[model samples]
Target: MRLQGKLAIVTAAASGMGRAGVERFVREGAQVAAIDIDPAALKALAAEFEGVHTIAADLATEQGALDSIDQGVAALGGADILWAHAGMPGPASVEDLDMTAYRKAIDLNITSAALGAGRVAPHMRKRGGGSIIFTSSISGLVGSMMSPIYSAAKFGVVGLGKSLALALAADGIRVNVVCPGLADTPMKLGFTGRSGDPAEAAANEAKVVGAVPMGRLVKPGEVADAALWLASDEASFVTGVALPVDGGFTAR
Candidate 1:
């Protein structure tokens, strides 16, 4: 109930951390706008949440990001929190990287966050204050040899949070970033490949687990909880923080 009666907009909300965030916010008493690019997923989300507003839009563009926020504001009357969580991971290694794909990944992962916040800032300002939370990764703090592009993009997100925090503080708007370690999600499964040989899959899983000090992956709900805290009044004095929801991975 920390977010009772608040209005929120969560992008990439059809799956993974975004989907979990929408569910968590709703349970915390916030009216939420769940957005994603998948029409079928958005439809399912709308059906699943009676009062939630579901939006299907390509967040790779500034207009799409702005339009979705506009619709969300109109649906819920206004927005008190904006969680710009739309992103994609890039090549695991530079040798496997394609420039075109890398550009798209950076655009989707970094540019969308910047534009999404830019479009929503005015509306939050009109209300006198609001919170903006961007999604980052533990790779953001360090560098990922496996996915250098993803690491770079997430690093940009962390930078965005800090810069926006200082820029918007005068207007009572707080900007923060959540850096989650490896999480068990459909996307991760895709990246790891479920249909691979059993031995290969086991090895892959072991490799992932071995990287984290906790010996387990972060859960989507855990990331959502961190995001929920940042969006709620409990974090009123918290801003410009890159909170690590990682299981001590960054510690080592």
Candidate 2:
């Protein structure tokens, strides 16, 4: 029970790393508020988990991010952990610089996390201390030729996390960021499948996988494990760190 006696609020909790984090936290003895844009997914999650409180809210807007945190804290009484994990992949090429998609990517990938953290920090302070985990990408640490917009947003997340960690450290609130690489999540698959060509998607995934020193994609559960450690007492002394669970993708 690594997270025993804790209350957590997880954004993007319907699927991918968010869902995995929720499942792992619950099993480790934490009561969680699972927030996602999909009401159907939230309902399914609530039904699957005995004590999970599910909230349907878009995390892409400032109002949505704040309101989600409010609802979660109300439902769980207070929050000891906040995992602002909602994000999206933006335009793949500089030629396709759709401002709409690019702005949405910034809002969802980094702005919401910033808003959520601002909203949740006071609650954590009231509770003595807490842990806040944000999701970045290996692209955040480096750069990406495939998606410059994505890299920009992810880099913003990392910087925001570090700033928040420093700001909240005195209050006993620890903030950290997780950088994932070539993960086998719906988001990754969707990116590769965007061309609607099976062979192309397969080939794209293969090419990306070839770059990982571990010779495989990182699993959602593996990312969850890292978040769990950051949330639990095990990482009490850790803060302001951007840990990469990329199977050595950043090692090179």
Candidate 3:
């Protein structure tokens, strides 16, 4: 009940961290509007939940972002919490990276977040307060050999959150970024791309485990919990922080 009666909008909510956040937000008493590009999954989610609004839209585009926000506002009465969590893992290195792919990754990961926050700010400000949570990553704080473009995009998110927090403090809006480490989610699975080889996937996953001091990948729910805190009154005085929910992955 931490978010009782609040209106929340979460992007990329069809699966992975975004999906987890939608469920968590609802359980915490928030009226949630979930957005995703997958129509089938969006339909399934809408079928599974009551009072949850699902929108199928490509957030990488301005029109898509605007439409999603407009619908969420119409559904929820107003926007109180904004979780801009849509992202794609880009190429591993500069040498092998495609320029088009890199730009698209940035659009999805960074630009989409900017648009979401920009649209929600006026509504939030009108209500006299709100919380905006950006999904950054530990990669944002450090270099990642696995995905340079993704790291850059995430890093941009952290910067965006901080800037917004400072700019909106006078208006009573709080902005913060959550930087999660390796997490066991559909997106993580996709990164490995194990072709019908469970053992190889396990081994690949194990490598991630060894890198974290906690000895295991973080769970989507764990990240959701952190997000819940950030979006709730418990973090009333907290803003402009890029918090690491990385299980000590960046401790070194």
Clashes of each: 1, 0, 0
Candidate 2 local Cα displacement, residue 231, angstroms: 0.4
| lDDT tens digits, residue span 1-252, model 3 | 899989999999988788889888999999999999999998888887787998889987889988898898888999999999899887767895688878878988999999999999999999999999999999899987777789989999999999999999999999999999888887886555526478877787788788899898888988888999999999999999999998899899
**Candidate 1 global CA lDDT score:** 0.89
TM-score of each: 0.94, 0.98, 0.94
Off by over 4 Å in 1: 190-201
lDDT for each candidate structure: 0.89, 0.92, 0.89
| Candidate 2 residue spans exceeding 4 A from truth | none
Candidate numbers sorted by lDDT from highest down: 2, 3, 1
Cα lDDT of model 1 by residue, 25-100, tens digit: 9999999998899999988888888799998888877778778888988998988899999888776667856888
Per-residue lDDT, model 1, residue 67, is: 87
lDDT of 3: 0.89
RMSD of 3: 1.7
Among residues 3 or more apart in sequence or in different chains, the pairs in candidate 3 whose N, CA or C atoms overlap within 3 Å are none
Could you tell me the lDDT of residue 233 within candidate 1? 92
Worst 10 residues of 1 by lDDT: 189-198
